[model samples]
Target chain A: MIELQQINRIFTVGDQQVHALDHVDLSIQSGEYLSIMGPSGSGKSTLLNIIGLLDRPTSGTYLLEQHNVTSMNDDTLAHTRRNKIGFVFQFFQLLPRLTALENVELPMVLEGIPPAERRQAATETLNTMGLGERLHHRPDQLSGGQRQRVAIARATIMKPAVILADEPTGNLDRHSGKDVIELLEQLNKTNMTLIIVTHDPEIGLRATRQIRMVDGRVMEDNHKR
Target chain B: MNTPDFIRLTLTAITAHRLRTALTVLGISIGIAAVVLLTSIGEGIHRFVLSEFTQFGTTIIGINPGKATTAGGSIGVFGTERPLTIDDALALQRIPNVQAVVPVVQGNAEVEAKGRGRRTTVYGVTSGFPEAFRFDTAIGKFLPADDPQAPRALAVLGDKLRTELFGNENPMGQRIRIGGDRYRVVGAMQPKGQILGFDLDDTVYIPTRRAMQMFNRESLMEIDVMYREGTAEKIIVKDIKRILQARHGKEDFTITTQQQMLDVLSSVLNILTFAVGALGGISLLVGAVGIATIMTMAVRERTAEIGLLRALGAHQKQVLTLFLGEAVVLAAIGGFVGLAIGVLGAQLLHMALPAMPVHTPWIYVVFAEALAISIGLLAGVLPARHAAAMDPVTALRAE
Candidate 1:
């Protein structure tokens, strides 16, 4: 479960103050498939960043799993981010030098896992993503859809509680984008909390719960499918 | 992360830019090689000079006129000093443990031998000269032990002076004129090469009292006292001082022990070695600069990777260690390569110039490698800290 109350994110540009998030509040329960959809500069990405613990709110009281995460130290925030949250970027940010398996094994590697155990687990994870044959291929050598799948595998390798995808299919073709969305939906069916931030109405409508924002404020929330 | 994994990661990053890494390594290697080679030469010269000085014998003490005020800044040479005479030299021979005494009066003279005249240094010495200074006679014999006050007009030609004035012809029993005095060549000395630029093979020796009359001086320039081995230096110096002070009615002479001279010379040469080593260290400092520059550039290039590592739960300390590890590995490789090149270069130099002494001590070899590693650690600090301090969000967004 995640809760936000009176969360405000402000940006100072030279002499003026811009409110990226204007005193908005929202709540979500476990196993909810949700999407934050708005036009450009609607603060959807900022909200997602705050929820992912990548950035702190200017004024916020954020509670994730009944713990006040806004008051956590930087190191604790990093620990919580790695253990409780996962991210799939639109660009499929895989390190170019690492193979598909190595990219997926990175999270466990940072966790100080042994080489043999992590190697086996990363192989299985990549194999389940239908990248068994492409396990040794680098990102530069893989197809766009395959790269996105690798990124998805890397995100879920640590078995985090929630998955945050920011325009996960923005850079892919229609077919691969559909494949990525179906894979994500499959994970959602397994009771993983899935939150997506996108401008595409089709992708936004696929979520069981949808929220639309305007000028840093939540204008619409449709919780019933 | 575990050490192996951490090393692998660092190695991966270093090998990513092969050309850049090679260039950085080359910079550090050149510095280490410079340090090794320069210090090797300095140490070689240090030993060479010491052996040359000690070859003449180390137990001999020289008593020079005018007590030098070595303890404080004062001009003792300008004081009224009594000139040490042949009598002082004869008195020192009576002291216990005294082996031989040679009262010296050195002067340049034109010697005419075999109708050929040449200018050479003439040494006014006694019969104990050859034994006391370890000089050998290549032919005939040295000056015989005759009466000190009145002795034969015998001359011992130096090795080079024999070759110059006599050629292949035997100079023994030949008459040579030294400063308008005719003397018979009793012997020719064995070839002893130069000592501190003084040609030991180009000098002539005669009786001390005769040379004092030839140079026309009342006091001997110096009196050399040769003592038996294992004799304590303080006792010999004390006995010589007591006799000379009693005869002169004051302590007007300076007695210099060979050990004291050796200690002073050894310390001066050590400083010379350290100075050259420091000069080489300057280049090593430049190499450290090269490492710092490359590491800083690497940090800039890998900002996104750093952010990703942080996102994957790598701590700030981990990021710092990764960068520092890369630096240390680079420097260590360079150090090894530099050591090989330096030792090989020293061998090649010795082979090319056999007369030049070249020695590479093992301690310097070990120290040079350690210096390279420490330089790497020091150079990596600022850049590693900068990389570790980067904000994850901003770094991830960087192109």
Candidate 2:
């Protein structure tokens, strides 16, 4: 479960204050499949970043799983990000120097997991993603779809409680984007809380719960199921 | 992370930019090599001079005529004060722990024998010269212990002088004219080589009384006293001063102990070594600058990688340590390679020129390595700090 009350994110460009996320409030329960749809500068990505604990809200009381994270220190926030939330970037932010298997193993490495266990888990995870044959292939050597899948695998390797995807299919072909959407939907069906930020109406409508933002405020919320 | 994993991570990053890494390492290596090589030569010369000075025996003391301060610059010339006489040399023998005393007179004169003539250094010394100065006669006996006040016209040819004058023929009992005085050669000295540029093997030795006569001087040049081992120099020096002051009615002579000379020599040599090492350190500083430049570029180029590691839960200290470790490893390897090359080069030089001494003190090797590593660490600080302080969000968005 997640809760936000009066969240505001403001940025100063030169001398002007840009309200990236204005006074906003929202809530979601466990296992909810949610999609936030908005135009450019609608604060959807900013909201996702705030929820992922990568950036702090200017004025907010954000509660994740009944614990306040807004007031946590940077180290505590990083720990929370590592253990509780996973992020899928639009660019598939995989390290170019690492192979697909190494990319997946990175989270566990940071967690100080044993090498053998992390290796076995990474192999199994990549195999499940249909990338077992491409374990040692670097990101530059892989297709766009494969790279995205590797990023997805890396995001989920820590088994975080929530997955936040920001335009996960933005750089993919239509067929691969469909495959990615289906994969996320399948994870959502397994009762993992999934929140996707997207501009695609088709992907937006696929979620069981949908929220639309205009300017910096949430303008609509609808439940389709 | 575990040490091996951390090392592997750093190695991967360094190897990724192989040319840059090699160039940086080469800079450090060249600096270390210069330090090692120059210091080796400096230390070698230090030991060489020390040995050269000590070869005459370290317990010997030299007493020169006239108060060293009163005479100003012409202390050893005749009429400076009462010249040191043969009696002064005999009186020193009465002191405790005194082993042997030899009166010394020195001058350069032309020697003619078997129609061959050459100008060489001529030493006027007592018979105790062999035991006091550690010289030995190779073919015949040294100057007989005749009366110090009056002795026969006997001469001892140095190995080189004998070969030049007599051409390998037996020079014993052969008459040689030294500065217009004919003296029968009694012995030929073994090859004692050179000491501090003084050719010991290219000269001749005669009785000190006769040398004073030949040089037309009334005073003995110096009275050298060889003291026994285990006797403190202070006691020997005090005894010599007491008798000389008693006889001359004032301290009209300067007594220099070998230890005093050695102390001065070693201190001067130590400074030479340190100055050369410091000169080499300038090169090392340049190498450190090279490392700093390269590390700064690396931090800038790998900004995204740093962000990725940070995003994966790497602490700021961890990121700092990673870059720092890479720099240290680079310098450490370069230091070792340079040490090998430097020591090997020194050994080769020693082989090529056997006369030139080459010694590499082990302490300097350890110190040079430690200095190289510290240089690397210092050079890495700014860049590593910059890398560690980067904002993960901003870094990730950097592309």
Candidate 3:
């Protein structure tokens, strides 16, 4: 479960203050599959970043599992991000120096998991993502589809309560993008809360719940299932 | 991260740019090698000088005529001081712990033997000269003990002088003219090599009284007293001063213990070694600069990696440690290589030129290694700090 009360994110560009998120309020129950659809500069990605704890809101009272996460320190926020949420970026920000398995094992490595156990888990996760043969390949050596799959494997390896995907298929072909969306939907079917921020209406329609934003405010919220 | 993982991470980073890493390592190694080689030679020379000075035996004391105190005016401003006499040498023999005393007078003289003539140093010393100065005869006996005030016409040829004048012929019974005085050669000294630039083997020795006459000087040049090994120098010096003062009614002689001379010599040699080492340290400073430059570049190039590590939950200290580890490892490897090369080179030099001493003290080796490592750590500080302080979001976005 997540809740945001009067969340506001403001950025100062030279002389003007841009309201990226303006007095926004929203709530979502556990295991709900939601998609945030909006045009450029509509605060969709900004909202996702705030939920992922990668960027702090200028003013917010964000509650996750009834705990006010907005007041936590940087280190505490990092720990929470590591344990409670996972992020899949549009550019697939996998470390180029590491192999696919190593990329997936990174979150567990940060959690201080034993090497043998983390390796085994990473191998299994890569295999389940249809990348068993590409386990030792670096991101540069893999195809776009395989790289996105590796990113997805890495995101879900920690089994976080919420998976925030900000245009996960933005850089992939239509077929790979469809496969990535299906993989995310499969995870959501297993009772994981999945939130996607994208401009694709097809991917937006596949979500059980959809929210549309315009000019930094949530304008429409619909539950389809 | 575990230690092995952390080290591997650093190793991977370094190995990624092999040429750069090798060049940096080479810089440090060259610096360490220079330090080790120069210090080894410096230490070797230090020991060599000390041994050469001590070869005459450290238990002896030389009493030179005239007080060493500087007068108000220039040279000869102070009227001729009383010279140390044979009686003064005899008086010193009466002191406790005194084993032997040799009243010495020295001058350059032309000596003729078997129609060959050469000008060389001539020493006028009593029979106790050999014992007091640790000199030994090669083929014949040293000078016989004769009266200090009156002795027979006898001469002892140094090894080199005997070869020059006698040409391997038995010179024991031969007559040699020293300063126009014909004296029978009684003995030939063994080869004692040079000490402080004076060739001991290129001189001749004669009786002190005859030598005083030959040199046309009434004052003995110096009176050397050899004391027992266990006796303290202070006690022996005190006794010598007392009797000489009693006889002359004042202290007109300066007594120099071997220990005092050696202390001065060793201190000067220590300074020489330290100066040489410091010169070598300049090269090491250059090496450190090289490391700093490389590390700065590495930090700039790996901004994204640093950001990724932070995103993976590595603490700022961990990032700092990773970069610092790479630098230290580079320095340590370079230092080890340099030490090996330097020590080997010194040994080879010692073999090639046996006269030039080449000793590598272990303490200097360890010190050089520690210095190299510290240089690396210091050089890594600024760059590592920059890497550690980078914002994860901004760093990840770097191209």
Candidate 4:
């Protein structure tokens, strides 16, 4: 479960203030398949970032499992992000220097898990994502669809309770996009709360609940189940 | 991370850019080499000066009247009419630690043997002059011991001076004129060589009785004495000073021992070594700047990697240690290499010049290398801190 109240983020660009997020309030129940749809400057990505604890709200309260994560130190925030949230980026921001297996095992490495156990767990996760044959390949060597799968494997390697995907298939071909979407949806069915931000109405229609944002404000929250 | 993994990662990173690491290490090594070479030069000069000084005998001491303590090393003033006397030499022998003291009455004079005339120094001294001046003869001996009543017409020529005056003919038992006085060459001197600008070989030795009589007036301008073993020269000097103060009723004479001469030499070498070492330190500083610049560029290039590590949960301290690890490794490797080079260089230099010994003192070499490493590590700190302080979001955004 996640909740955000009265979130407002303002940025100064050479004496002009741009309101990136304005008084936004939202909540999501556990295990829900949610989609946030918006145009370029509509605060969709900012909302995802705030919920994932990657960026701070200028003025607001954020509760993840009813704990106020507002004044947490950088280290604590990183730990919470590592343990509770999984993120899938549109561009597949996989570390280029590491193999797909190593990339997936990165979070475990940061957690100070023992190497043998970390490798064993990461191998199982990659195999479940159907990247068993491509485990040793780097991101640059894999196909667009394969790279996104590796990123997804890394995201869920720690078995976080929530998955926040920002355009998970924006850079993939249609067929590969469908495959990534189905895999994400399957994880959602298994009771891991999934929040996907996309501009496509077809993708938006796949979610149980759909939210539309316009000009830094929530324009609509429609039940599509 | 465990230390082994940290070390492995550090080594891998450094080896990733082999040429850059090598160049950086070379810079530091050169700085260490500069330190070694400069100190070696100092040691060589010290050895050379010490050898030349020891050649003139250890126990021998000289005293000269102050010539207003002038600019060019205390030059004797022109027309300084005072000369030393036989009574002064006798009086010095009476003091404790005065082992065979001698006084010289000196002047420039011409010598003629078989119409071969050469200008040479004429010195009238006591019998102890031969041993005190470290004379080694090729032919004959020195004058007999000075008897205040018996005036001997004796002369001793330098080894070179003998050949110049007598050629194949023996100069012993021959007579040569010293200005207005004729003296027989009782024994040709063994060469005493040169000592601190004084050409002892070119001078003739005669009895102290004859010198005072020949030089006409003698008020004892100087006195020379040798000290007993285990008794410090300063003690003898104090006793002589006390006796002289009582006899002359004034503390006008200067007293300095052979140890004082050596102390002055050591201090002079110390100052010279310090100056050369300071100059060498400048080169070391330049090397440190090179390391700092390289680290800065490395930080800039690895900015994305830093972000990735941070996003993976690496704390700022870990990032800082990563960079610092690289720097310390570079410095330590450079120090070891430079030490080897510097020491070997000193040895080869010593071999190339057998007459001059340039020691590679480990204390100076090890100390300088240690300082260089510390400086290099310090140079890396600012860049490492800057790299660690970069925000993960902004760095990742930089892509």
Candidate 5:
């Protein structure tokens, strides 16, 4: 679970000061599938980054399971982020030099997990993601769908509590996009917090909870049965 | 990382850019070669001079008429006025370590043959001069000891002077005119070519008695003495000076020994060798610059890879060490290869030019190698810092 109270984020470009997030307050229970919809410059990505702790708010409080992580040092924040948070970006950010298996195993290696266990866990994770046979293929050598699949497999390797996917299907064809969203939804069904940032209305409508933003403030936060 | 794995990684990365790595290493090789070649020349000349000087009879000491300061700033052979006499020679021969005493008188004279004439410097020496010089005559016997008494008008020609003035004729008992006198050739000096390009084979030697008589000098101006080996030349010089002071009642003569000659030769060589080594250091400087530039480019090129590694939780220190490792590896390899090449190159040069001995100072080569590697490591430091200092977020944001 996560809580936010009057969170605000500001950015300055040259002489003009811009408020990216303004007095935002929100809450998400565990296992919630949330889609944040916004027009260009709508502060959806900024809000997601703050929630993911990749960016800090200019003011106000953010409580992730009652931990006020805003004041934590970089090392402590990194440790918390590594253990509990995973990110699936629009570009699929898999290292081009590494094969699918190696990329999936990266988070475990970063956690200082032993080699044998890391490889074995990475293998099982890949098999569950239907990429066992394609484990040795590098990102460039794989299809867009396959790379996204490998990215998703990597993002979940640490069994993180939260998954933030910012336009994960942005670069995929429609069929692959459908498969990626459906797979994320499956993870959400298993009590994993899933927050998808996107501009697609059709994709936004399928979420159990939807928040729409325009300019810098939230326009709507609607929960659907 | 463990040392073996780190070494393997460095090797793999270098091998990935084989051409660039080889070129960088070649830069260091040239620096090493320059040092080796220059030092060899210096050492070769030194050894040649030393060997020749030793061969010309080191036990002999010459008292020249002029003040003799060393070529370098070591001993000052300071005295003037041609202050020696035959009485000094006679007194010096009575010293404890004294073996032979010879007085030499000399001048330049023109001798002619078939309308061809060349001026050659001639030495006027006693029969004792040949004994002091340890020269063996091959063609004819040395002049008798009674020559100083009867004062025979006979001469001994050097190998080159013999060929020049006689042209294959047995000039023995034949007359050649020089210095207002016609002297018969008594014996020829054995062949000894040159010392540091100074011709040893052009001089003509005649009896010192005849020389003093011709030059119209009643006393000896230069006294040459020979001493027994393992006897301190200084002690013998002291003995001669003591006897001379007692006889002439004045301390005004100078003595030179073989050890002094060797010292002068060493100092001359050290300067030349140091200059050459310094010049080669400039090339090594260029090689260091090469390493810095290459490391900078490598860091710039690997920006994304660095971001990727940081994303994998590599610390800033680890990233810095990786780049530093690459540089250190490059330098260490270059140093090892350069040392081998430099030493072998010096030896090969010696073989190629047998007349010029190419002396390889292994200590110097080792020092150069150590410096080169240190330069390599130092050169990489800044670039490695740049790579390590990059912000992962910003780097990832950069295309």
Candidate 6:
């Protein structure tokens, strides 16, 4: 459902050129659970960002669901991202001023969904994440684990085909980290494709497809499924 | 996004920083209040002056002897300028829509009545002075319609002058001496208040021909012609000029219509109102700068949120509108508050000093509010554009 051909992401810092992603080629099918593991500056996050449509490669042709998304305009790209992809960041990215329910309703708000309906959907999604009683709690009021759960609810509210999570469990305690992985795996069981970028080997190895990147290139690709 | 949600979002951002928003709003309100208050006083004075001038009626024209033209050199009395006489005043009555014509000759002279004497303004005018100038008599009557070239030596005492000279005794039919000439008092005029510090109620009125002879002047100072309302001034002025030119064999008189004076007065007053309004606009400009500064800071502080909104599929226009909405709402609120304060302040001032005139036209109120909104739009544009143009990736990374 997603494809990239010879993607290159180069950054110019003053006089030197840095290749964040060099001649990278990758493809993923529907319902696939994948992980990109590498050290800092290995460009795993850059690759994930490229796949999420958050960053454009200097030279590449990207096809999402067989539509050429590489040459799409900014507004079209934004619309594609909204309808087909969801992102969960290491920082959770929940607006500090909004409650958990409101944070989860953000994507639908952008979609111009009716208030009563979006509110109902957000409540049910939070309830299923075991946050029924904490729906009105702000991010500052919730624990690290509960906040990640709210972020996950927010990401999946639009039912995007692919989820891009960059260090989703990086900020949580070990116990809560395990809980977040379990929640993501639970979504994978429902046929939602999930892609995780992490430095931790334990979490990285849980995916059906694991790829290790080094020096802006894929060093290893293993399929356990 | 829907309008309600958009407004709700903007309001949430504004309410997050309550103190800053309030201070910015206060800045704008003060500017608007100054505009309203100053313009009110300006407009009030405008109307007040106009009423004072128009009280004598607006359809009268004054023809003064000697052309008021800019001459190359001082000719003194050697210039062959014909004096406006009682015959010239009579010739003006031939014009269309002519109502009453009064030949005017004025001077200061000592008047003695019932053994009391004082110097006062003496107006040499015919019977039509009352009708031409809208002056009324309190007791008896105004000057009789005696012959303009040769009239009886009759006098009319002003309300104030009658009280000073007679002391409860009727001045009518009593003898008074004006410029060493004895005249019988015909009437006492009602109290017509002062105009521009000139005491109209402290003057005496006598026949124009008699005063012209008493003052030993060849010219009738001015010939005032009152015409029926709704007659175009140009027609009467042309007729007066033609007749005067024919009699004097040249245009030696300057005819001034009341409307022309009013037009000049109206323009001067308009400029005064605009000048004061512009002064208020300076403060409003400062308020606009305040809004711009606050909006810029807001955009800088909310970079991550803007990125989040963009990632959530909000258009650039939406982001721009969000920030602009905050600014416009701030200005609009300030405008309403300022309007209330300004109007209330003007009323309070009027009450505290009843002599000071104050009027706030509804148009100015509407304009002030509209100006506030425009200021918001102008000030918010740069910051809002900056916010909208920010890259989502870079903005999301901002702390």
TM-score of each: 0.88, 0.91, 0.89, 0.74, 0.70, 0.95
lDDT of 1 by residue, B1-399 (tens): 788888887887888889998989988998999899888989999999899988879999999998766544455544667799888888899999999999999999898987898888999999888878998899999999888889899999999999999899999899999999999998999999988788888889998888888988887899999999999989999999999999998998888988999999999999998999899899889999999999999999888888777766677888899999989989988898888988998899999999888889999999999999999999998999999999877888777
Poorest 10 consecutive residues by lDDT, candidate 6 chain B: B69-78
To one decimal place, how large is model 6's interface RMSD in Å? 1.2
TM-score of chain A of each: 0.98, 0.98, 0.98, 0.98, 0.98, 0.99
Candidate 2 C-alpha lDDT tens digits along A73-98:
87787778777887788888887767
Who wins the lDDT comparison? 6
Q: lDDT tens digits, residues B21-117, model 5? A: 9988887767766766677677777677677777867888776543443445434443323456665666677878777788888777776544556
What are the Cα lDDT values of the candidates? 0.90, 0.89, 0.88, 0.79, 0.78, 0.91
Best by DockQ: 6
lDDT of 3 by residue, A100-204 (tens): 998898888777788899999999988888999999998999988898889889888888899999898899999999999999999898888999999999999
Scored against the true structure, residue B244 in model 3 reaches a CA lDDT of: 93
Span of 10 residues, lowest total lDDT, candidate 6 chain A? A77-86
- The predicted structure with the larger TM-score, 3 or 5, is 3
On DockQ, the stronger of 2 and 6 is 6
Docking class of 4: acceptable
Regions of model 3 farther than 4 Å from truth: A63-71, A108-112, A156-159, A189-192, B70-81, B228-231, B348-355
- Which should have the higher DockQ, number 3 or number 5? 3
Q: What is the lDDT for A186 in model 2?
A: 79
Number of residue pairs clashing in candidate 5, backbone atoms closer than 3 angstroms, sequence gap of 3 or more or interchain: 1
- Which number leads on TM-score? 6
Candidate 4, superposed: residue stretches over 4 Å from native: A1-3, A26-37, A51-53, A64-67, A75-213, A218-225, B1-4, B54-236, B258-265, B327-357
Please give the lDDT score at residue B30 for candidate 1. Answer: 88
Error of 1 at B94 (Å): 5.6
Model 4 RMSD in angstroms: 5.9
